[model samples]
Target: MKTGTVVGRLWASKRLPELPAGALIEVQLDHPRDVIVCYDPMGCGEGERVLITIGAPAAWWFLPGQQRVVVDALIIGSLDEGSPPTMPK
Candidate 1:
């Protein structure tokens, strides 16, 4: 899992049938400061802080029962408004 802010949204006219119902969003990672695209089934909007899952977990878990997606990244949850918790050193 990773923490990030939704920076933007993407539009696609065509997509795979296996892809679930959702919109593509761009997230700016808090740690490495890199941008990535994620599938959003929770209807996330721009500027919302979100939790993302990648790789196999994203493809397998973040969907309805017995269904799989082809996404590399998926938005799992949205964060509440406030400063994020500090990491222990």
Candidate 2:
């Protein structure tokens, strides 16, 4: 999974029937000027740091019998008020 911060939301003029119903958000990665759009079912808000999965893993992460929605990036989890605990060296 990749980590990034939610930057903005996307609104399409027309909706696709095959796509899942959720908010499409823009996430900014650690790389300079690198950002991507991710599908969010977990109700993540802007400025929230999120864990995302990309490529085929993202599309398959849903249910088995669910329609095959072509998803490039998906927000799997969100970081809370504090940073994640680090493992000891």
Report, for all candidates in order, the number of backbone clashes: 0, 0
The residue pairs found clashing in candidate 1 are none
Clashes of 2: 0
Model 1 stretches astray by more than 4 angstroms = 62-68, 84-89
| TM per prediction | 0.81, 0.81
Shift of residue 87 alpha carbon in model 2, Å: 16
Cα RMSD, each candidate: 2.5, 3.6
- The superposed Cα distance between candidate 2 and the true structure at residue 21, in angstroms, equals 1.5
lDDT per model, in order? 0.84, 0.81
Clashing pairs in 2: none
Candidate 1, TM-score vs. the true structure?
Answer: 0.81
Worst 10 residues of 1 by lDDT: 61-70
